[model samples]
Target: MEVLERLFNVALVVATLRTTAPILLVALGGSFTTKAGIFNIGLEGQMLVGAFFAVIGTIFTGSPWIGVLCGVAAALVLAFVFALLVVTFKANEVVVGLALNILAGGMTVSLLKAIFGTRGSIFGHGLVGLPVLRLPNARDLGWFGQMISGYTPLVYVAFILVPVLILFYNRSRLGLYIRVVGEKPEAAEALGISIARIRYVSSLLCGLLAGLAGAHLSLGYTTMFTENMSSGRGFMAVAILIFSNGDPLKILLGCLLFGFSDALSLRLQTFGISSYLVLAVPYLVALIALFALSYRARPRIIQETLASMGRALSVKPNAATDAEKAVTRG
Candidate 1:
């Protein structure tokens, strides 16, 4: 009991915030594409590209902020290509997104080899990581301060954007335009809204948010770039967006859930569990959540299936009891 309590402490909550920040940010970005009626699956690749560029930019400029800008810029360029292909040329979104992910994976590795004469990963001097927020009176605040402060700027920004985005998603003209464009392209067209333009904007915003996510992964705590470091986080974000249906509050809750799972998984590893099982815990939770969401989406089929299963499992009551109960009710 003591062990379990220690494992699930304030520190775990703090770690969850850091663990969830990247995916949460990426989900927000992906939500835009979802709302705009675009099926974007290239978030992983965009994030990978962003991570690489962020490292490179920091290496050259010795400024993490410059790295962030470069990361976003690189993601925007890729996003434009994606928008052009999918929006203008009428390419399949899933195919384009998958292709982009593959391209990013290959390209980042090749660039690493060419630029640093190394393969797989890169790290060293001049690659300034994003700075942690040091509270002015941390000691005075005690344990709560430890949990609340000391995260990177991006962490705070990601959380702050939740309310801001919720407001924008419901109230802003552009948000409404994107929704109309996605849900009813014909109506949007009749109202003089350009479907292609709205989609392009959506893609761009997704890329921008993805880039921030990638940058945070690479620079939030360490100035290092690893191959395939995103490790399916983009897919997780997509799944979350699907489950939430672009609802900001739901997305936030989903991020917290996934993030807590991830953090807990890591904590459990210290208790002598198998490393593989520990790693799979969070992914398994995500898969289950996604399955549940998909099932819920098909309520009629699920209800019928459950009813059939219940009937099959149920045993018949005694015939005498049934007769007596019926006669008593009458």
Candidate 2:
């Protein structure tokens, strides 16, 4: 009972919100690419590059906001490269994305060593983290204040983007174009919509959001950049994208679920649980949730597959009958 009480508390909720921010940002970015029918797996690499650059920018400019711009800029460069290769050159997106991830990891570590002279991590007195936003008079509300106040600005931005993106996808012209391109590229092209341009825009948007997520991690979540500090949140964002089916509202829910498991893992560590077990909690929850979702959708998938096969078979018989009739007429 004590364990349950400790696990379920206002503090836990706050931590969950903090942890959810980065994942939410990245997932939201991935949603743009997903809507454009682009399968970008390089979100992890983009995020890592952003985090590293954000720290470097902060050290040089003495400002976290500048650091965020640096981070976004770096991610955008990477995103541009991704678009050039995958969209313009017709390269396989999966292969390019994986290569970029590898490149980002190695490049960050090498840069860390060369620039900062640090091997595994870089943190010192010169780093500037983001400021927390304290709501006026919210503290008077007790537990409510704890839940609603004292978060970095990016956290608020991440949550606010949910509704903003939903509106964009549902009501905006560009959003409709992205959806049309993804669903029917040929038709979009026939309508004079440039598929390549839409894809490039989507990729860049993904990079921008990924950059923000990384900046939040280094500047807000913690004022340091460890080697590979993104810690698979990019991939987690991809998973969230898949689980949410690119819906902004469902994406928010998925991020919260992941954040809750992550926060719960940290909380469990304080209760004398095995560190390994606690560390595995978030991934385990993700896997179980994915499995459950797949299982629930299995019947529908099978039905669709069977229907397609039946249609194919029906087409062949009709073709044979037509051929036979033509021969008889001749």
Candidate whose TM-score is highest: 2
lDDT per model vs. reference? 0.90, 0.94
lDDT tens readout by residue for model 2, 1-330: 987888899999999999999999999999999999988899999999999999999999999999999999999999999999999999999999999999999999999999978799889859989999999999899999999999999999999999999999999999999999988999999999999999999999999999999999999999999999999999999898887778899999999999999999999999899999999999998899899999999999999999999999989988999999999999
Off by over 4 Å in 1: 302-330
Clashing pairs counted in every model: 0, 0
Candidate 1 TM-score, true structure as reference: 0.89
Clashing pairs in 2: none
**Model 1: per-residue Cα lDDT at residue 284:** 97
Distance from true location, Cα of 44 in model 2, Å: 0.4
> Over the stretch 204-239, how does candidate 1's per-residue lDDT look in tens digits?
999999999999989994569999999898988888
Quote the RMSD, in angstroms, for model 2: 2.7
- Candidate 2 yields a Cα-based lDDT of 0.94
